[model samples]
Target chain A: MDFVQLKKNCKKDASAFPGYRLALLGDCATQHLAMALKGAAYEEGIALSVFDADYNQLDAQTLDPSSELYEGKPQGVVLCLCTEKLYEAFTLSSDRAGFADATFRKIKGYWDRINAHLSVSILQFTFVERDDRVFGNYALKEETSFYYQVKKLNLLIAEGTRLVKNVYPVDVDSLERRLGRDKFSDPKLYAIAKMPFSLEALPLVAFETVGIVKALMGRFKKCVVLDLDNTLWGGVIGDDGMEGIQIGELGTGHAFTELQRWLKELKNRGIILCVCSKNNENTAKEPFEKHPEMILRLDDISLFVANWHDKASNIRYIQKTINIGMDSIVFLDDNPFERNLVKQTVEGITVPDLPEDPADYLPYLQSLNLFETTSYSENDRDRTKQYQAEIGRILLEQSFESFDDYLKGLDMVAEAKSFDPFHYPRIAQLTQRSNQFNLRTVRYTEAEIEKIAGDERYLTLYFTLKDKFGDHGLISVVILEKRERELFVHEWLMSCRVLKRGMEEFIVNKMIETAKEYGYASVVGEYIKTPKNAMVETIYAKLGFTDRGDHTFVADCATFQPNKTFIKE
Target chain B: MERNEILEKLNEIFRDVFDDDSITVTEETTSSDIEDWDSLTHITLISEVEDEFDIKFAMKEVVGMKNVGEMVDIIEREA
Candidate 1:
């Protein structure tokens, strides 16, 4: 496959929908590979910019900072060294330690500088071994020296990547196993095309690199539609009964328990767990509720529609019940028939390839690597409990005659705080994910968030909500960029759990008051429409914002008028 | 065999694996030269080539096949 075609496929994947900005930086050895990426970007609908440094004059700092060369805020950056060329750079400089540490430190410095300058994810590449004779230069003969240097550089980069949470090392060696040698060795193709690696290698890297970005960007499926029977346990609950099922302490039963434990972790991360099994509802309910050793519970599940219906239809009902998109769902079942049924019926649902061995369950589940959440809030620990509390609140709503009476009974408190370094990582994650209630779903990396913090014109607000039930954690994030006489609300998004809590209004009102104090004449905001965010379509309109076509809604600070019954605590 | 036939075969391999018939295989064609040609597809392409050409490529050889011409040369030698 060509890199271009693979890139197209990547764009089609739900995870890379809005796509990301990618920057390619490499030595002369990778010139063709870089150009091929540009071509791939054109075909795949992904935005990728390639930068080629002159081989004769290769200085990282000398490269133009503002040169649209690096203009796009790339989610991932690829840095490569042709083994022989690096050997040349090593020999060219008389001070070995100077070049060694300087080169390694420069890579780290690049990330530090970029973290301050660019709002994107970074991916660094290690050097691949080349046939010694390929290079015309002779002093580089101990090619092993360059190989060791490259390996050392990769380890250093990996260490740096580990330290900075946003950086990733895309080791070509791991990629080579998946893609063979014939495709990777063609120098002519690479030299001319700017893609010298195997036809197989590029897409894997492109997808993997993009996967890393998507993960860093904090965009992942929100729900897992599970099939009972062999999925949740080793055997069927109806036929085998609770005693016959294997879902208890260690050994054969322990594998299933481990899986259930994994599911518990997934649930804790705010992934709504829903059971869509084709069995007696009570039977399925027994394992979750009555089974003493069960890791997940009836309350743990957001929806339970266990009837003998087409699994796809059940999944559809769950999606609607949860008020989420079909794309944000993963269907898991041991039965190939059911998995195939859902895959054929549900257009966007991700059905991972399940293997035959029961022992393969952990690896199979791990392989899916489906959910990639970068931001974990304190609320994440008790997500199931909080959501259940929301369910309880729903039940109490029926008893109350008035909305305020119900609100007053709950004793809800909404607290807004300024962005602190301790919460920056999760705050940045919220910016990347949290789609539905988002004013403008502007995806950003933590590095970029740090940069935004330094700029005085911007304000990043974090909101914490709790009632008598439990702490809902930091659930909402709003970013405002202010200019002379006016403040622009760059981003505003709240966790779906806190949607109806009147927190959005409270935050907007806070922004308005803040703007007034700053002497800004008006507060401007935008309501960008997305496939899943129709819930917030009339938010600005309801808050007394005037529509300024093209989805930009504005509110004049002085003239703004709205019914406010905010009981701030 | 003529270089053109070899190129055509290589091009067919790229087209079939990439699922894009429009790709014309030049001697200089490499993964970076084409889009959608990432590491995963690179493996798929190599496996397809192994089945097509009936040749086993070593780690170094596979890594070395940077372009269509290089892939052709490696295949012809092994074949």
Candidate 2:
């Protein structure tokens, strides 16, 4: 749905949407963009409250320390500017190339000022050039052409964002290609209302811009569950056999090749892949093992559940194994019956209606934009391997009679201490995305983590566990605030993959160790109950802390001792 | 459809858009007459009218609208 429909839905039932605050800064009239954004945000479960400055108030809003933009205290900020206005500014001086340098300086200054003062995620747009023939195609080479200048500015903006902490460039160039520039702009509107973009394109811009906002707010998918047979390939695997299955660069099968290749790319980028198909295990595994043309291999799949069982139950098992929210999974099946069944049974899983033809699958999937992430690190490349190792560990646990015996046999070593540059992004990500085992459920941005890393009054610890199977990369974080005469546990978050493996016991033991070493009288912890965090609700009491009402618990530091554990510090 | 017929349909849309069943708009009525008719909500009203009447409105037409009658007149012309 576009902005108009979303706005109408929100207006019909405003209470259904959760409130999010945003500051809008623009060179031209931005009332339409602000309205469209709120509607789009509300559609994405963010009932947006906007703090938009008047036209041409970008300087006043960012530079003035006491401006309303600062006082409003928005969580996300958006800046929208077009080349028409920039071109107008350039014409004031015969030295046109100077405009490019001047504009860059102004933008970089705004970036610096915004960074210094606000702790908000800034979402800014790159210019989509107006196809004016100031120098025709030679505008491509001319440094003075507004088109080339905007292109250079966009590149600089992207490079600067890569280095700068919290700034993100929303590529309007890509969006303009998607919706043609002629369709996206209106000359009459630009002339009268100073609105460069057309009414129809406002929703498109709002939707893309809000994607960044949603990523900042920790509302995005993590896994994509797929169906084999007609879904992945053009033919059924069980009936068609390995050779009979339509695949490779021939026939209608090439579509399946395209789909498989895309899915593999998503897996490599840290999106977990799983199979929920009704087929014989050998038949399903046959293609990946024997077929030379298949793009996806066994190693790329984190979990494969190809069986006679209903897909909904298989999806539940996958969720239990992954320990992520149902909202974080997108299920794809060619069969409408299967899709509807899973949709009804699974509360929050996204099940898009697949087109009748297989050719449309890739384009339809692309439009959903299922996998959204804030940062990419080296750790992401081996995510499928890590999850596969986790599954191996789970299977090994089934063999041992006692869970403790399984823990002891694994030979686990945990590295726990204050944060460093290497673990900073994952550490911040854990705070943002982790829900079930998160104590207090406080989400932190990378900027806030940088602050926490250096603050003396707080103890910021990151934990990484590696055992016989593989390395569980940087799994847990604990932030302890030093109280007057005690050390209060400000936050304790853990990756659920490492849960029930004596890691929690080691973390708590370490907290008490710090309290005793620092000569603090007591160590306190709190468990805030969220719908998803019930598993860790009574965690403090289980660890032998005296329960105080209102989700608070405390223990004497002097009396605390290490629990039995296989982990070596 | 006649203007009165369109008004009947538009009133249904107004109630749905505003989330208030009691809301009844007339030719003389403007955005100020309704409690929820702000700049943000103006788009929702326009969208609902367009959908119900199966028409489109220009940016200038939407922004330049003075009252319910002007909106109805534009929709009728387009229809």
Query: Mind giving the per-residue lDDT tens digits that candidate 1 earns over A1-569?
Result: 45545444433434443455566666644544554565455443355545544442224432557644346555566665554456667767676545545567877776777677676666776656443343445425543344445556656766777788776766665565445655554543443333446555655555555455555555468888888888788887899898888888633777778888998888987888888988988888998888888898887787778998888888887776666779778888888988898899888788887788767887777754677555567867766665567556765676899888877777778887778888888988888888788878898888887888778889777889888766778898878898888889898888997676677778788888878888898888887788988998888888778888878888888887744644365
DockQ of 2: 0.11
Candidate 1: residue B76 Cα off by (Å):
6.7
Which CAPRI category fits model 2? incorrect
Q: What is the lDDT of candidate 1?
A: 0.70
Evaluate model 1 with DockQ and give the value.
0.08
Cα lDDT for residue A465, model 2?
92
Residue-by-residue lDDT tens digits, candidate 2, B1-79: 7999888888998887777889988998898999979865676577557767878788788789999999889978998
Q: lDDT of all predictions, in order shown?
A: 0.70, 0.84
Model 2 chain A is weakest, by summed lDDT over 10 consecutive residues, at A3-12
